[model samples]
Target: MKPSTPTRLFLLWMLTAPGCGLLLGLDDFEDAGKSTDTVSDTDGRCHIDEDCPSGLHGQAVCDDGTCEYTCAPGFADCSDSPGCETAITEDPEHCGSCRSPCAAHCVDGVCNAPVDIATSASSASACALMEAGDVWCWGLLPNAEGGSRTVPLPERIELPLPALQVAVGGTVFTGPHGLRAHFCALLADGTVRCWGTNQLGQLGLGDTGPHEGAQIPNVNGIREIAAGTDNTCAINAQNQLYCWGPRSTGLIEGDTTPAAPTLIAESVDQVSVASFHACAVMVDRTLKCWGLDFYGSLGLGAGGPTHATTPTSVGHGSNFAEVSCGLTHTCARSSSGVSCWGNNANGQLGLGSRTNYNSPQSLNLFASQTLRAGASHTAAVIAGDVYLWGSNAFKQMGSNDAFDTLLPVRLSLPSVSRLALGERFSCALTAEGRVLCWGANDHAQLGDGTLVSRATAAPVRWR
Candidate 1:
């Protein structure tokens, strides 16, 4: 569905009010001067929900072939009251019930943590780092299916230690025998833990046995971690890089099996893992990439190796703050502008053409604040506005269509603070601490409690 522009106050209400659902066409509430007990369409004319008036006291729907008002989701009529009169879930005066008070903050109809949430996504699942220092996951199960394949909603996960951040990898061919997908957690104590799909040694578990559950590796002093389609990498406090997983084409070099974390480079500031390669930003602000460059993803000059098993310098320009790797391309934010290279068949390069480039190309159009690359698309934040380009087969570009763009298209969303891109979906964390997503929802990865795809940004239901 096309998500409408929401006012600040309405967004606040949605975030704090449990079961509010996504109320549409209710922005002009001035006409609703006084609350009404019930609302009915006297003019017997309506085929869809939108045909009803906007100011109706509750959810407006076609009931019994007539327009009527009902309580929104997560809201209900008081036992003593019926019809349109309602009790909200998070309201302190009606906390989960009529006339109840909350001792703390109300969340999902209950008083709980007041912290802003951080969200992460794997290919088929997404996880949230809650304010209470707990991680909750929702969406499709990695290798398991049916009753065991989906969580459907956010469910708390038991971790041995408090997780500061979490990263999830894709599910396709990620396990020891290519049988499972995985996710990794960076704990508050600077330690690293990983689980699932150890077949390729992505878990760095030393052995591939016990492919399920979490594994706490002795590796310590880690500061940042990133997971890829099948492998994982981390940068320690010392700025050294360590990686583990199956050896595809020397992305990690000589590793043939599930191996312990191996140091790859030093003085690394940030690291990003893609489907078949990885890129890093060094303390000197230079970019380096390794692994398969079948489509010139490494961004090395034409004279450079087709594929570098070891890290190779990208372009001469230093001043890079961060870098992100996609399925077959790489994007980095430099002091000058956003630089992208590699696959352009889907216009992911945002270079205004489908032609690929072997060297870094600057997008001199806008001042990029942040950048994220998906399987066949790229999203960058320019002055708080997100611009998306490349594949939109599932409306991942928030245009509500399947057309591809050779140039960047601004997403109609509020100022974005961060972005996470899945294989065929995209999510943005708003400045207000709310999560919004669009694109494919085959596995409920969009996290709106539905399996329907959205062409525009829609709030992810945390409640």
Candidate 2:
């Protein structure tokens, strides 16, 4: 139900009220799909430096939402505080506060970014990548936020104390030093901590809290972490994978969130979490998944007679280097090329059709090493060229076509060096040191300049 005019006015009036309660209401009222928010933020509105919080040091905020900052090119805190500025420039410690301002991209006092890979459990909680392998998180972390869009990037979280590590067996600890009691760092010590919303036991902490940031309990020796839709998967130094959330239908992304990450029942060198599923590459390059396949995201079967609760092979293929999953579809790549399947309502399957597919469809487009799946679209990078397919209702496909693409369309972005896929938007890193994004500008995730959706792509100067 839409709020009435008087209700909107009431909301605005309460915006100035007391307590963090207002903040909560603001967060709740802001419409869910938004990946970015700029309401009462000091830098919320701006022009030049003086109009900004820190006074003089940021981008202009035209009718559209764009704020330049003093951080490095690809990073901005957007704090805009009186003395500090916005998070784009918030961390005096990193940029203005700390020494590694641009590098750390701190928000508040902790290094962080607001973009989270939303899904079931990891949603409400902030996914934190700690320094020296100590990961921690804070905020409305839900133990059941599920759906994909959980922790997309590592951010610094406000820590009243050092991060506490939760064990696979449900043992909890406080402080980084204590985590070492039964755990060993792995994967160059890349720390990925998850809290808030853990129904499937995705936190691996003996099950507790559906929307609270309680550290998982038991077990030890950990490193990297990835949250699927309803599961949580982690890795140790030996490249071993351990998942526990929604094991049935690959929803085992830890607690109960699908795609959070659960033991796929396979040992692999790598893994990738998708909307309601997850994929992994064995040492020999074999691909496997353990989650929902109603849309054929799990491969093996067309999904439908029903969903599976355990890991399944993705067709006997090899040299499969990478794989990605979306809401109703799945796509992966091998030495031969890319193959995808599942729901094509918006062409998310990338198989060149809007028709639902229960069978595998070869992209037969350009070849690439990286593959990404969006809620209803698919993207892949072949060398430096980016190609996309599927639904374009919100331009999530990155092209100017308002309809779905039966085949892949090569997107030439000379300014782009890297590519990332969001739920409804696609972004890339430019060779000229800039950020280019397009599609579903609704939540301002496009970071372009306006709320208007785009059929083509646009450049976003994050700095």
Candidate 3:
């Protein structure tokens, strides 16, 4: 029953008076339409989802009057913070996603990948072409001052277009005149770009100014390129060979200056240039060589001729697959096996002896997929294994023992797809696209972020 207004007022006043024991109940206020449930008040933390701040990993949201977060792909909120904080793109411990570990390197959400690698035979520098069409280099790199300097870690090289192949060439002399180095990159458009020391017009820019991104003039449709101590060569899609630079050892004939490309030979499949000589494998699988034959490097038989001004046939067969020219030696792979000629002062021929061979001398090993001849060393990949010989004074053989060997010695490594050799160092490209290097690191040629030389293979540090 409802009480009179005066009686209700007296009851409320008695409950509110001092020393009153009864507590005020909401039952009397129900008729005023008041809510019984608790309502939340956000004390300026956030009013809407857009009011919350986003962190490195991306977006945030407001829910139940509180700010919550969401992570973008390749990121995660692995910590107790209110923002997404972890990046899984390059973290080996959590590559691509949380708890997805990688064996060696993590790059752009993938693991252990590189496409091609090139090392200078004269200086301690190297470059690698990544699968993403970017180029990274280390060791003695070219500086903007038209000179070169040593770098202990990998640095990205800017290019106007994607690169298909990269080649490094240089020459080291005694005394104050130290190193003359250069680099060339073949773009997807069949144009060539070069930079570095251009004292002899090796950069192919029509002038010797140590330029960068200098394109070879009047040349297009080139399929391959090779650089030597002070010269460069290219082979167009039509199998025509062209060469430029100082006219030495018959590399260039007549009054053609070193500043312009000149036609050298035709139907050439592959060509390799060195300090004073050059060699090529014709389309018919026949090997031809010209230039100064130091210690019979031309493979024209002992006591034959000291120099050949024109392309002359070498060996006795047409099964030649490829050839590599070194400082004073040459090595070639034919259908039979691997054969080497010329300088063997350090047993670079892998012939199990210190005696130099004027003609082709076959090694006991079988066919090789890739072969390289350095200043005084040689490296070959046979059945996925690396075989190295010649000078070990710099521990380029991937062994701690600094002793020269005349026979080929196997390196402790995984399946190798390709190999590149420097004067005192070596690098190999693994089947998994990972790059491993050893030997001289005086200029950080190994790309391991240190100047200390290594006797065994170590993974390159990208960062």
Local distance difference test scores for all models: 0.70, 0.49, 0.76
Top TM-score: which candidate number?
3
Best by lDDT: 3
Instruction: Estimate, for each residue in 304-347, the C-alpha lDDT of model 3 and write its tens digit.
Output: 67878777899668798989988789999988888998899899
Model 1 global lDDT (CA atoms, 0 to 1): 0.70
For every candidate in turn, the CA RMSD to the true structure comes to 12.7, 16.4, 13.9
Each candidate structure's TM-score, on Cα atoms with residue i matched to residue i, is 0.74, 0.57, 0.80
| Model 1 bad stretches (over 4 Å) | 1-122, 143-148, 172-179, 211-213
Task: Please say which candidate is ahead in lDDT: 1 or 2.
Answer: 1
Residues 1-463 of candidate 2 have per-residue lDDT tens digits of 9986444543563455343342232221111110222334344443333232212222333234433333323233332222212232354334434344332244334543222222211112222233433432222222233222322223234333444332211111123211110111122324444444343444545543343343343323555554444445666556677765544433442333333333445366766665466777777888777656665666766433344555566675688877766666778788788888877787666665577766556778546857777667777777777888877776766666577776788876773345556555676654443445676654344544356667667654223
**lDDT leaderboard ranking:** 3, 1, 2
Local accuracy of candidate 1 as per-residue lDDT tens digits, 250-358: 6776646655778889999999998778899999999999988868989987888977888889875899988988888888998888889998999999988999998
Better of 1 and 2 by TM-score: 1
Output the TM-score of candidate 3: 0.80
Ranking 2 against 3 by lDDT, winner = 3
Rank by TM-score (best first): 3, 1, 2
lDDT, model 2: 0.49
- Between candidates 1 and 3, the TM-score winner: 3
The segments of candidate 3 whose C-alpha lies over 4 angstroms from its true place after superposition are 1-72, 76-86, 92-112, 175-177
Among all windows of 10 consecutive residues in model 2, the one with the lowest summed lDDT is: 176-185
